[model samples]
Target chain A: MSYRSIKLIKYPTQEFTPDVFDITTQAIPTPKEGEFLAKLSHLSLDPAMRGWMSPDTESYIPPVTLGDVMRASGIGEVVESKNENFPVGTRVMGLMGLTEYAISSGQGINPIPKELPAEAILSVVALPGVTAYQGLFEVLKPEAGQTIAITAAAGSVGSLVGQMAKNLGLTVVGVAGSQEKCQWLTEELGFDQALNYKDADFAEQLKSVTPNGIDLFFENTGGAAQAPIFERMNAHGRIAVCGLIADYQTDSPAPGPSWLNIIKKRLTIQGFTMPDHIHRFPEYAQALGGMLAKGKLKYRSHVIKGLESATTGLDLLFEGKNTGKLIVEL
Target chain B: MSYRSIKLIKYPTQEFTPDVFDITTQAIPTPKEGEFLAKLSHLSLDPAMRGWMSPDTESYIPPVTLGDVMRASGIGEVVESKNENFPVGTRVMGLMGLTEYAISSGQGINPIPKELPAEAILSVVALPGVTAYQGLFEVLKPEAGQTIAITAAAGSVGSLVGQMAKNLGLTVVGVAGSQEKCQWLTEELGFDQALNYKDADFAEQLKSVTPNGIDLFFENTGGAAQAPIFERMNAHGRIAVCGLIADYQTDSPAPGPSWLNIIKKRLTIQGFTMPDHIHRFPEYAQALGGMLAKGKLKYRSHVIKGLESATTGLDLLFEGKNTGKLIVEL
Candidate 1:
């Protein structure tokens, strides 16, 4: 059998464009001993993908090498298996890359509940959901009455964070790019309020919504959007830095938030990546899974068609065009 | 009786000079219904003094009001007491300001063991020592055999942090401004290694000394000194930001450490103030006080004579001229 795959042609110096990658055809080789063959069905476009494309050596995960298949997360069905853990017809989720077929060595790939829809597996039961769970409960540790503020409020992680925080009785304020996203955040996600970051009166709106001051800030987008909200932080506030989508496009240093306020407010800022917390995945899947099973939790995804639209799907993530999880239905 | 006092005539916009304050004579005020008369002896000069003098409204403690007595920490003898908590001849420590005498409401004032010397009380058993203790043990939570890097290694808090971390079986690397300070950190304080930030090969030296990578960074000086060490931080490193003397002189935003590294290394950076942790003071006083009594810990002080020398003494702190705790002897 043969399959098509997106390969990284060159690393982006500033921002990633479609020209940096190209589609190539390859023969689907047999699985090695203790390995499985996964035919990808869905691909997740995450903000961290931009960081992985950087040529810099500072990232936790090494940069995706040129001429290699672009790395990504996806859900797929096993076509063949030499491993007892993953038999043929098993549904799995992992770093399956932007490819139609993947030969997994049983390292990162994990079998998931086939009953759940592909969208649910990729959104709430996969990387984004686990990230929100760990970053909120373990890192940020918000109390019930505390006010929580987040950027990219309508994105996969930010939307889940607001809903989870609301479930715990915390006041939630969301910042998004457009008025429609803001309305969705408040109406669908039950956020206390949502403000459009592009509006000239964004800071004023944030001030009015968070009259008690922000106790926890879930920072998904950095740069100008984050700096103003940081000034509204309360004493002993906690900031969980999940991603920096705003600054991921550029190689040059981004403007920083005031360090003096960190001292003045006695803030605790922690930066986390979910890959490091794979041990707690089952716990996350159980908690976030149960909420999704009920009507208590909800998620949305902007699904693009085919492996050919992978780069465009990622572009949708950067432009804030997609209201929820940006995905490619292969 | 008459006593001399230093009043804040003008707040410093840049570096503080002698003209910002003036020493004036006033009659010793009598104790009120619940107040006590404290005859101040050794006034502590700290790096946080720069923050208190900032005209900006962002600080843990409110900025010292213009024409008011400059706020400070001091070791004093209670000459008269109208409250039962404090009695005549009690050796107490509190915010006694830069004054020959002060009338205390007995709120912050605490009586110390009469046997402990003024230098020990001011240096290792007071605000600076408790700060180092809480930051290292509580916030950073360094494990044994971990490599810890500290800036301002010869100053009051940094010096104690080195000694405490060394005692806890961590390899301590200190960064200071001068060779003499480095020598004091390594030879006297038993630091594993010390590097002069002024050295042209400062970063290279840091790389060599901390070959295992830094696990805990006690950040005393921010800006240029911190940026290099941040590059050498190990995965999941903890940074206890005790102070930022490097950026305290100016209100305009300073160049910050790389946020990308914070995410890449999965760092936990917490900014803390000792005043907020008063509940833990007795615990610190007990642990550190016992260490001081047993000769397990040591401290030094640069004492300047008279209330008139208060401004110059603070200048010594900013210049890095004082080898240890800078204090004004009145």
Candidate 2:
């Protein structure tokens, strides 16, 4: 069978667009000895992909080079296998890329549990859920009654962060781009309050919702939206720096919070990557899986059909168009 | 006896010049029952004074109100005493203000040991030394052989930070304004290397000295000086945010290091005040005092005579004119 794949043809100098990718067809080769071939189903489109597309600089990982298939996490069905671990007809999830088929040496691929939904493996069980669990519990250690304010509340990580914080007895206030997203956070996710950052009175709304000032701020958006929330942080507040989705498209990093307030308030801010939290995956999977099974956890995926739609589908994340985990079904 | 006192007549709007202070004469008042009087000797001048001078804001302590005596830490000889715990002729250290005499109810005063030099009480045994010790070991937590780059490396706190980190077996790089200050850091204080931030090739100089990348950054001077060192920080670096002396003179808080680098490097940045670390004072004093006694630690004081010099003496710190702790000898 032939498969369609997207390869990065050029390094984006300004902003990332579909023009950087070259869509082409190639023959799907059979798995060699000690290798397995998986038919890719759902490809995860994330904010960190912009960082991966950038030219090499000081980073946790090297930038994805040109002429390579766009790196992504995905779920697939093992159609052909020579490896004993991943037999034929087994479902798995790993760095399957934005492609129709993947041949792996079984280094990173993990078999998904039959009881869990296939999409949940990509959304909650795999990357976003693991990230939310670690960042909330380890990085931003909020007390039981402390208030937590998270940005990108309608997104995969933020939604989970809100629900988990609430489950742990902490008050949660979510900040999102639209009223619909805000309503979903407050009404469905049980967030104490949700503020639309696009609203004229966002700063005031943020203050009204978090009357005692925010004890923990889960910073996903890093720009103008961050400035006001930073100003309202309580003394000795903790900030878990997860993503800077706002500055990904910009040439340089956007200006951060006022250092004066940071000094005056004695705030502790830490930036973390999810890869470092892999050791806690079993711990997270057991907890997050139990929550999901008990109906205490809820997740949503904004799915787009076809491999050709990968380019435009990613832009939806940058524009905050997707309401949850952005996925491209190939 | 008549004594001259510096009082804040008006709140400083922008840059702090001599005009905000009113140097006036007042008779040395007698101490009431349960109160003791001390003849103020040496007073500490700090960059944090600028923050204290600001109108009411969120802070660890309340802003120094107008019409109040300019608040400062000072060494004094107890001339009159009603409180038996503090006998007359006892040399004490406390918030004695910018005055020739201080009347205290023994709230904040601490008696200084005769074995310790009076200047040492104000420099290493007091605020600056305690700040450096805690920020280096407790907050930053740099392991031996790790590279540490500090801003304001010639100032009271920075000078001590460089020395302490070196004593702990960490490689030290100091950042100062002039070549002389940089020389003092590397030669006198035993810093591994010192970079003059004012040099034309400061960025290159920083990169050359911190060949393996900075593991701990003792951030003292904020603004332009900090931006370059931040880029040179290694992954999983720690920043002990001690002071933003560079931003004190400005109307607004200066922008800090790039949030991108913070996320990319997974930096742990924390702002700390000495008051918060007061409980650790006993621990710091024992360790730092031992180092000072064994001739392992040395300190300097830039003493200006009279309360009249308080205004210009403070400017020296802002301009990086002082080689060490800026003190006023009354």
Candidate 3:
């Protein structure tokens, strides 16, 4: 039998182009002595993938090498196994790459429960959930009654972040790219206020919404909304910079707000990536799963059909076209 | 008997022009009940004065109200006293303002040892010393063998910070505005390397000096050198934003480096003012004093003559003209 896999052909100079990746057919290989071979059911498309495609070796994780399967996290079911831990029919998830089939020794892979749907697993129990949990609880350390402003607020990670903050009694203000996302944040997710960054009077609206000023900032997208939110930060504010999706595609990212406000307000700005805190994934996933089961968290997936769609679908995240978590279902 | 006092008559719109201050003659008042009359001998001129001269109430401390004695820290002798804790002839240091005489209830005052010269006391045991100690040890949390890049390396606070870091076995790179200051940092303060920020190849020099990349950044001056130093920071770098002398005078401060590097390197940048940590002053002062007594700390004072010189002498700090700790002798 034959399965298809996409391989990165070249590193992007600025932004990803279709030519950067090439899909190839491969015959399914049998598992080795201690390995398990699985057929991937779903693939996750995240903003962090942009960093992985670049040639920057200094990043949290090494960039995806050319001529290799494009790196991704996915849900798969074990079809063939030489290992007892991941026997036949066992569902697993990890950085299995963008492929219909994968072989693993269970090094970084985790056997997931069979009950949850693939969309829920990829959206809330995967990278997005764990990242939101870590950034909101650990980095921002939100307090009840504290106002938090999260950028990309309707996206996978950000939506989870806003929901978690709201559940903890924080006044959550979400910043997104479109009015529909903003309405979803406020109406569906119960975010206190949601502002569209594209509005001409966005800064004025931000100031009006956050009368007491922002105490915590969960920065996912570093763009136009950053300066306005930064200016409204109260004294002793803490900022958790989880992602810079807006700047990910450009070689010349915009300069950040002046550090004068940083000093004036005695702010703490910390940047973090999930790879650095990978060891805590299982622990974070459990907490997030509990939140999901208790109905304290709500997640949406912008599912794209087939493995080949992932190449072009990634731009949906960069362009803010995706309504929720960008996922590829094979 | 009368004393000369400089009062803030107007808030500076951008930079400090001489007209903002008024030299007023006042009768030296007798101590009432708990108050003590201090004959100010030496006034410390710091870069923080620029912030105090502004109308921005959002700053760390309340700006000096117009028509009040221009706020400053100084060393003085309690020539007349009503309080037992501050006996007559006792040497003291505190925020006594820009005056030849001050009356105090000894609220924030710290009685100092009569042995140390006013220069050494103000430079190493007062604001500069405690600020440097707090920023280096507490904020940056230096680990031995790590490299630290300190801006305004020849200034009072920066000089002590570099010296303390060097004593802790860290490789120190000092960034200054002048060749003379750079020479002092390397030769006198024992920094591993000192680069003049004005040099055309300053960034290249910084990169060469910090071959392993900067691990800790002591950001004092937010100017042309900031971007270069920020760009060279290594993974998990910690930046302590103590002062921004370069931006204090300008109404429009330059934008800081892109947040992209913050994520790529997982850097933690914190802004702090000494006022917030004032409760720990005595503890920090004692440690810094011990370092000074053991000859582990070296400081030089650029003493200007008379209280009247303070209004103009204050500009030396903003202009980066002061060779050492700027002090006004009465």
Which candidate number maximizes DockQ? 3
lDDT of 3 by residue, A275-314 (tens): 8899999999999889889999998999999988998999
The reply for model 3, stretches above 4 Å from the true place, is none
Report chain A TM-scores, every model: 0.98, 0.97, 0.99
Candidate 3, pairs of clashing residues: none
TM-score of chain B of each: 0.98, 0.97, 0.99
Task: Candidate 2: list runs displaced more than 4 Å.
Answer: none
Please state the Cα-based DockQ of model 2 relative to the true two-chain complex: 0.81
For model 3, give the TM-score of chain B.
0.99
Instruction: Tell me how far candidate 1 lies from the true structure as C-alpha RMSD in angstroms.
Output: 2.0
Per-structure clash totals for the candidates: 0, 0, 0
Model 1 achieves a DockQ score of: 0.59
Alpha-carbon shift of residue B173 in model 3 (angstroms): 0.7
What is the TM-score, restricted to chain A, for candidate 2?
0.97
- Whole-model Cα lDDT per candidate? 0.88, 0.87, 0.94
By lDDT, the better pick of 2 and 3 is 3
Per-residue C-alpha lDDT of model 2 across residues A63-167, encoded as one tens digit per residue: 888998998988898999999999998888888788899999998778887667666766787788888988899999868999998999888899999999999
Better structure of 2 and 3 per DockQ: 3
Expressed as tens digits, the lDDT of each residue in A158-177 for candidate 1 is 99999999999999998999
Q: Encode model 2's per-residue lDDT on B9-72: one tens digit a residue.
A: 8878878887999988989899999999899888899988887888856787888788889999
Q: Report clash pairs, candidate 2.
A: none
Per-residue lDDT of candidate 3, residues B1-330 (tens digit): 888999999998998788899999978899999999999999999999999988888888999999999999999999999999999999999999999999999989999999999999989999999899889988899999999999999999999999999999999999999999999888888999999999999989988888899999999999988999999999999999999989988889999999999999999999999889989998998898899889999999999999889989988888999999999989
- Candidate 3, residue B72: the lDDT equals 96
Q: Which of candidates 1 and 3 is the stronger one according to lDDT?
A: 3
